[model samples]
Target chain A: MSGIELKNVTKRYKENKFEITALENVSVQVKAGEFVAIVGPSGSGKSTFLSIAGALLKPTEGSIMINNQNITDFDEKQLSSVRLNQIGFILQTANLIPYLTVLDQLLIVKKMQGTVTKEDKAFALELLKDLGLENKEKKYPNECSGGERQRVAIARSFMNDPDIILADEPTSSLDTDRGHEVVQQMAEQVKTRNKAAIMVTHDERMLSYCDRVYRIVDGKLSEEVRTQEV
Target chain B: MGLALKELLYSKGRFIMIGLIIVLISWLVFILSGLGTGLSTLSTGVLSEAEYSGIVLEEGSEFSLSKSSVNRSLTEKVSEQEGVTDTTPMSIFRNSVRKEGAEDAEDKITDIVLIGLEPDSFMEPNIIKGEAWSNSDENQVIADESLENDGYKIGDTVVLDNTDKELTIVGFTENKTLYHQSALYLPMENFQNLRPSSPDDADVEETVSGIVVQGTDVNLETFLEDEENVEYGTKEETIEGIPGYVAENATIMLMLWFLMIISAFILGVFFYVLTNQKTNQFGVLKAIGGSNGFIIRSVISQVFILSLVSILVGIGLTYLTVLALPESMPFYLESNMVIIYSLVLLAISVLSSLFSVAKITKIDPLTALGRAE
Candidate 1:
């Protein structure tokens, strides 16, 4: 209840006056301490569901609740506030700002709301140390490897202490070993910090870190029974 | 502010290049403004800096103060006119002078312009050294300080060409020039006696070239309408009548305005392109809960700091350049003009970044939703 919930959310785009549904009646509840993975092929409405769930886009129908507050009727500015205070996002390929240092990458999350206090800086540094980014705080994103940059992005997502962490293919830019390391860090942070996390990834090898897996075919969403490898 | 400062510091090369261009542009702006102000002051400071508003010249002389001559008694009549505050009968004579005991080779060494007005009148330039003129009957002169560069010194006796009359330099003054030639201040009675071309039969004490008139333009014009062989002009109009003043001022000011316009456009486009280059980053910031207000503030802070620093440096450069120039150049830069131009340049530069702010507002955080890192 203190995480993110989407109730029968549907998103449609009007293409040349003909409606194309990107998502249809998808209901998902990611509670505190849960790591959920939504996997599907390209153009399978995975991004639309995540965009709605993160409050970056509004659904044509149905409501979203974050920390038990309904966000469906919220305006654009209100939605942005929800994104800032309640949601944390880790986009594909680390999506780190090139000009910012690793530590600033984390602190910028706190800076967006107001002045970043000393405690906020200590917390950011602690998060970096916890994620194995010690001695890399002053280094820029370009100076770090793809795996290290992705880890910084993970640390940045958790910097605001948001209730829900949304990651869209965070490991897509890394190789197998580094990709596994980045997802492992994300899952470890979710369970240890008691934060809800939803990662949308196509790489099946990374699904081992998720507590629940949901598959999307076309615009429909349904849960897949947690299965073992062949 | 944190993000803005971080980005500016992180990308020093790009912003420095842009900042350097701004520095040069603002430098040019300040230089041009200084030159424009310098030329105007050089041409018209004798009139504008004086307390009186206008002058009366003989009508047939066509606003040429040198050729105009009038009855000194008209000073009293002009003072009685409506709205007239005061009047001083004055004379301007173009002359060449030499210091006493100079050899023939040094003859005509200084082109001396003599301005004849009452010693304590509004037309008298405040002397920076030596004594003010004390007698209307005795020969006394307050030479411009520029004369020092030409080897003329205070208390030295000056001898005019074609005549043996000696006018002793009594003091030195600053910023007095007419028709691009430095002037020496002297009393009206002595100017009448010492003029080289005066006819022997003329009453030197009863004649003047013009009257320095102080009053509202309307009353002056009305007084002029009723008068014969004379016309009235405000100080600004009198300045325009100075040879080469208007034409030189127009060209320099035209270029100054054009430079400002171009600088504004260049600065605006630079910021716009800068914002365009980072629209993806801005989008990402928005996506992860960074609001438009935060992003706008960052962009504004970046632009304001760059402009402020660049303009300040430019002004400093301008002052340095002014100091490096020779003293003979007509280059006078006032503190007020510097302040005004700096503020204008700073404001336009900051305003230029608003286009980028507008672009920032339109950036959809949804573009940040799944952007490839």
Candidate 2:
């Protein structure tokens, strides 16, 4: 089953003096177990596309189907529910709450929606164990190394068992070895959890781990047609 | 709620500094509020409790006991009007009195305002000691507690000056002092007899400085206005007549209210600065599917908790200061409606926190993605 579908989507921002076309006529699809990479440079509208797919930004035109329901029409509250229940996001930086312990960082998402159930706690522990942070749950963000913090952040992203993970630049701050390790962990989660993962990155070395790779130029997504058959 | 608590604990220095500012300003407002109430009591303690339906004074003149005078005959005429329950003649005169024995006996001869009253008038109800002043020539007088230092007990005699007649200190009263002068109550006749005169002139006839009347008799004012014999006033008019009482109170209260307004804005601004610094954290929470309502609730709850604690400290400090005042200070710590009013003032600071919380609602969630660096 496909986890996400973007059909003929567009996004624009109108400022007081000018209108910036951020994304135009973009369409993409990812099966439940696929690992997809979106490659682009700084001003290529890749961030805007990830923002729309993650439900953080409303599209200026066209539709988004997540888990078979068209989500472009969702109200603020409904969109928030979809994000809470279905989507996990990773940004360029770790974005760990500096005040929270590694464990509390994961629990905050579950607690905000409701109380944290025991099964949720177990799942969080399982994710943290797989990310090699099993013994570091009690440490504050500042006490952890940069690589450790990013791994904790990845654990947090999947805490809700989301069906889709949208990582803006998951390895931009990591060294070559740690960056490959992070990408390998994301790819493993996509296959093991039967969830689709889309990573927006400028690092071409990370492309081999993705099941499909596409490049965004100007405002549209394009790829070699032979790879789409996969 | 728990997350906010943890976050504040982690950044204890920032929140505590804000809390300390709240404490200092709230303490100031509390003390000023107490003093404003206390000073007003010292100025108008007697009038506030007299419970007269109306005070009568000269219509065209400023209402002051010293400036408004009605003859004894005029009060008798006013008593004839309908709804006129009781009319008591009063006279206020400047005089000096001294204890019969003291080290600085001449210095002990302090300037005082002699408020002369009929044997049992409406205005003299707060007599806390021996008895009210009587009309007999036995020279009996009632003094406020400021004279406590002089050891003038009941039956002790003090001289009102060169007159052969003497005043026996009969009682001590509380909170009856006029502005800057200890008030002494004496018989209206004694007051008239003590009025100053040229050395060779004849003695002034016995008459009261004013009349305190009860009931809603509207005709008495018109009758007094037309009558050439004396002046009369309604109670509101009489209260206005007290010297500098209204103007002084209005100025002080205005200052106190302005301070409260400034404190509210200061608190609102402080919270704004705090919220601005946390925008990235707010964005991170937003990216994780945290609703705007959740983040706003957390901010408002933090401020509400901080303000309530600050007000508690402020009230505690004010209470201790008020409790230490000596009885002879002529200040009153009122115990009625003012308690509820002070609570409302504290609540305004708590209510002011909502403005900062509103700013959180306008933050765009998309900023979480692009804004993260």
Candidate 3:
């Protein structure tokens, strides 16, 4: 109830009177201290579902609840507030701002929230240290490797202590070993911090790090076998 | 503000390059404006400094003092009219003056404008040194301060062109130049002797070029209508009628405004392209909870900072150029005018950034999720 809940969510796109459904009546609940992975092939609407879950995109008909508050009727400004204070996103391609340093990547969230304090700075530093990027804090995104950039992105997501973490193919650009390490770190953060997480990925190797997995085929979502213990 | 400044610092080369372009454009604008001011003062300084309400010229002279010929009798009639305090006849003509011992050669002649007026009249200049006009002596004259630049001093003898008459400089006054030429003040008798007689006016009495009047209560329209072959206008309008005055000012102003608009367009195009390149980054920021206001503020702050610094640098450079320029150069920049132009540049910069702000507001954060079509 304190995490993210989606009920009968349907997303449809209309282009010149031609309607195409991207999500079809998907119902899922991600609880606190849980790591869920949704896996599907290309064009399976995996990204669309994650986008809707993250509140970046709205569904045509459905109700989304975060912390037991329905957000389906929220305006753009209110939705932005929800995204800012409640949702953390780890996007594909490691979208760290090219102009910011590794430490600034995390601090920007506090700046946006207009609550940057000494404690926030300390927590950002601690988050970088926990992610094993303590020494690379002063380095820009272009100066870091792909894996390092992903780790920095992960640190940025945890900066605000959000209620839910949404990651879309966060490890798609990493090697096997680095990808597995990043997913393991993400899972550890979810369980340790008691935050809910939903990862949309196509890489089957990442499923072993999640408590549960879901498979999406042709805009339909179904629960899969548990690959790891919670 | 921090993010905007950090980005500017991060991309030093690109921002500085754009900033330098602004500096160049601003520098040119400031210099052109200074030149425009200088040329305006040079063209109209004499008329502007006169303590008169109106000038009466002969009809059909197009307000040109050189082409006008007012009968000397009109002065008494104008002075006795209602609300007319005083009326003085004056003559202005361009002539060459040579130092006493100079050979008779064109190269030795210094071009000057000779103004003929009544001694002790309202048109007499306040003498800075030496004595004022004592009588209608044909051999004594007062020279303006600019004559000092040509090495002419009080008591120095100079020969007026076409008269074979030498005159001694008896006094010097300040701010008395006409048409950018040094002025020589002469008595009315000397002016009558030197003024050319028109072949068509063989039977006419002695005529003056124009009449300078004081006191403004008279009806100028009815007065001019009553007198044949006479037209009148305020001193300011008469100054504006000077040849090349309006056109010169207009051309310089047009150039200055064109530069300003082109600078704004350059900034707009630059920021637009920059925002286009960073659309994906903006999308990501929006998805991560950055509001439209925050993004817009950052973009505008960046432009403001860049414009403020670049314009200051350009103004500083212009000041340096002004300081290094020779006294002979006609370049005058007023401090208030500089401030006004700087504010205009800053405003233009903010307006230019609107293009980028619009792009930012329209960016869909969903694009950041990498959702396939």
Candidate 4:
């Protein structure tokens, strides 16, 4: 009951007068400790679905629920609060602020919540240690490797300990070995934290670690069962 | 604890450029303001040395002390009016004089304003070097201390041009200047002896350029309002009435206003450009639950800190530069004016950062969703 549930969500974009359907009645349920992967080609509503579930965008016609409360109709302030307390996003390319060190990157999330306490610092350090970034706390983003930077972003996303984590192409910028390390860390953090999570990726090789796989083609979604060894 | 401060520290080179601009602007403003105050004070130094209820002049004399040749007997009539404490008849003349031992060339001639007043009145300047020039003393003058810098010592003979009246410098008074020239105080009998006629060309009856009034302002104003021949001016109006005083002050004041506005615009543009460069960071912050309020406060706080530090440094620089200047330079900075203007600059600099705040408010976190680098 305390997980993200999207019920028949549809998103439309009106560009200059043309009403283009971006998503057609998409429904997905991601439960606690579940890592769901969304696979799609170019222009297949992957970003649109991730945006709506992450509270970055509102569906044109649908109700999105988190902990049994419909957040689709929430105002801007309420939506921002939900984003802060319930959802965490790991975007592509890490997106670490250039000025902040790795440790400050995680603490900044808590700072936005209100004030960062000593307990928050310990929690941030624990999260970084879980992601194997204990020594990189004082290092800036540019000083870290691509895989290490992505791992720092993962730790930052989990710093708030939200119920659900959403990642959009979390490994697009990493190479074969670093990409595996990044995605594996994302999966391990989700499982160890018992948080429901969703990742939208086009890389077929990264799908083996997922519990379930869903494919979207031309704004339509269909679940595909696959045999994989985690 | 502020993100703004951390970022400003991390990017010291970038913030220093804007800070430098602000410092230079504040420096220029302080210098101009000091000179403006200096110029105005230059024309009113003599007025500042005395306390007065009002300066009573002829009604149509345009406040020019020279144009007001009121009857010397008018002082008696005003002294009898209610609220009148005392009255003194005064005359003034701009004369060139030579020190007894100095060359008599045009270059050696010094400009001095001779003020012939009743030695017993309150208008008498405090004698510093020697004794006061009493009415009984013949050709005894108390020269301003500035004449000392010009090599005229106390007890030296000062000869007035086109006249046989040779005044012996009896004493020296400090900081008494008339229309930016040294004031030489003399007894009325000795001063009138040096002049062929009254400068205002009054009738043969005893005439005076103006009356120094020492009483309540309301009484002087109301009483003068009924008198057809005379009017009253408070200290401030008397200073403003000096020729070219209002225009010079106005021109400098206009420049100060425009400089403040221009500096604000420059600060606004600088902040706007920096904010635009950091849009990616702001978007990522908003995506990860950073509120717009937090970001706006960060921007404003950065502007406030930078502006405050820069203005303080500029004020320090002004004080240092003032120490290096010669005493003759007519530059003065009033404490109140400095405080008021510094606050205005700080306010404008902070207000200008609203430009960056507006840009931050419009940034959508969605831009951070599918972007790289």
DockQ of 4: 0.72
> Which should have the higher TM-score, number 2 or number 3?
3
- TM per candidate comes to 0.88, 0.80, 0.83, 0.89
Model 4, range B1-110, lDDT digits (tens) per residue?
37878888889999999999999999999999998887766666677667776677888888778667677778887787777798888888888788764554644888
lDDT (10s digit) by residue, model 3, range B101-207: 77646446878888888877898888898977675654688898778777889999998877757878999986677777878888887877776667797634468
Maximum-TM-score candidate: 4
TM-score of 1: 0.88
Name the candidate, 1 or 2, with the larger TM-score value.
1
lDDT tens digits by residue: candidate 2, A75-162: 8888888888899887767898888999999999898788998988888889999988888989999999878887887888898888
User: TM-score ranking from best to worst?
Assistant: 4, 1, 3, 2
Clashes of each: 0, 10, 0, 0
Give me candidate 4's TM-score against the actual structure: 0.89
lDDT of 2: 0.78
Candidate 1 has an lDDT of 0.85
Enumerate the candidates' DockQ scores in order: 0.69, 0.59, 0.55, 0.72
Better of 2 and 4 by DockQ: 4
How big is the positional error of residue A91 in model 2, measured in Å on the Cα after superposition? 2.8
The local distance difference test score of each candidate is: 0.85, 0.78, 0.86, 0.86
* Interface RMSD for each predicted structure: 1.1, 1.2, 2.0, 1.0
Choose the strongest candidate by lDDT: 3
